[model samples]
Target: MVKGALLAMGVLGAGMLPAFGPCLAAGLPDTPLDRARVLLVVQELEITLLTHPSATLALEAWCATHHMADRPVVVARKMTLPPADPVPGRVRADLGASATQPIRHRQVQLVCGTHVLSVADNWYVPDRLTAQMNAALDGTDAAFGHVVAPLHFSRDRLEFARLWSPWPGGGQGAGGMITPPAAIVRQRAVLRDTHGRPFSEVVETYTDQTLAFMPAVDADYAH
Candidate 1:
């Protein structure tokens, strides 16, 4: 599990922020205080994820930051495995012919205690994985990261998408407490073995549980 403070990277490139900058700019409350809060929240999210080696590691660190370090398990639920579908054009291009290597597709939810932090879909090249790694993946709910821990895999982030709240052009009124944007942030990346051969492609979605754990901001922050 991750420990101590995070070391964030510069992943959010130019324009992604201003283009989707604080919803306050859209005029909900529209105060300096509200805008600062939104920016702070977005920065926190960026830092938290940017520094982590992988979403799995990020979630583990988040659990530690949130004081759930006592429980070691981070993957709460490993839902049924679905037959791998035709790889996306981008993923196909990323992995090349290796993309056709027998795929093992799985969906899993990472949690800290009872709070589900993120849900992810991992499509991995089974032949690229060791026999032992494949066995663990097939027999248990262990996270792909954990299952392949022995391989000392490293991840390369390829893309990031911030899904805004209330579905493009939705309501923005204050309802209850300081409402943080009910948005989801997604990261798409490939995991490689120690030799740097890409073995898996994963897409992880940070869920509402993330906002619930952090300082709340405007509901329309990214609407």
Candidate 2:
């Protein structure tokens, strides 16, 4: 789970104070707020890519090529009992049983300029959302299974007035431009197994290019 403080930064509400430039670094001096802006742009692009249909199929094909196929199992048993002792010294044998392995699943989320895009799909099931994301991104096979699960994309929306408010004794000019603060965007995607256990989750915040993955989140797999 992402630190609660970071998560709190993405919440939306009235009377919420604007984040200062210093707060953007979260104590990392070298990581400037400007750098965060670039990361946000990349997140926006990622969201656009994920919404493309062709990209989705390309990702699926990539998974097929890279991942091994699930093996099948067969079972056989034999029992023998000599004449009839009370229960007879019975002999039994079993063969050809494979392990009940877990299935592979994936999820992706994108956050851009106060808008969030979420796509949740599984390798074993058809994914319409993935298809839409791929088409939007113009993605091809290059991004397939290699991208892995729990991918997150994020972007930031600027509030110019907030950036300038502290200047000149913190006074507002008669003609100063000011607008309502834009809400940060958030997207979440969860992938579940047949038993309704979530195998993967992708969560992203738009304002700071933050991505989080919680492998244990609950999911509904009924359908």
lDDT of each: 0.60, 0.26
What tens-digit string does per-residue lDDT give for candidate 1 at 97-123?
444456666767676666666767677
TM-score of 2: 0.22
Supply the TM-score for candidate 1. Answer: 0.69
Error of 2 at 206 (Å): 1.3
Relative to the unseen true structure, what is the C-alpha lDDT of residue 6 in candidate 1, on a scale of 0 to 100? 15
lDDT of 2 by residue, 57-134 (tens): 322332233221232111111112123212101100011111332222232322222212222222222232355544
**lDDT against true structure, model 1:** 0.60
Q: List the residue pairs that clash in candidate 1.
A: 23-221
- Give candidate 2's error at residue 223 in angstroms: 50
List TM-scores for all candidates, in order: 0.69, 0.22
Q: Look at candidate 1 and tell me the lDDT of residue 32.
A: 50
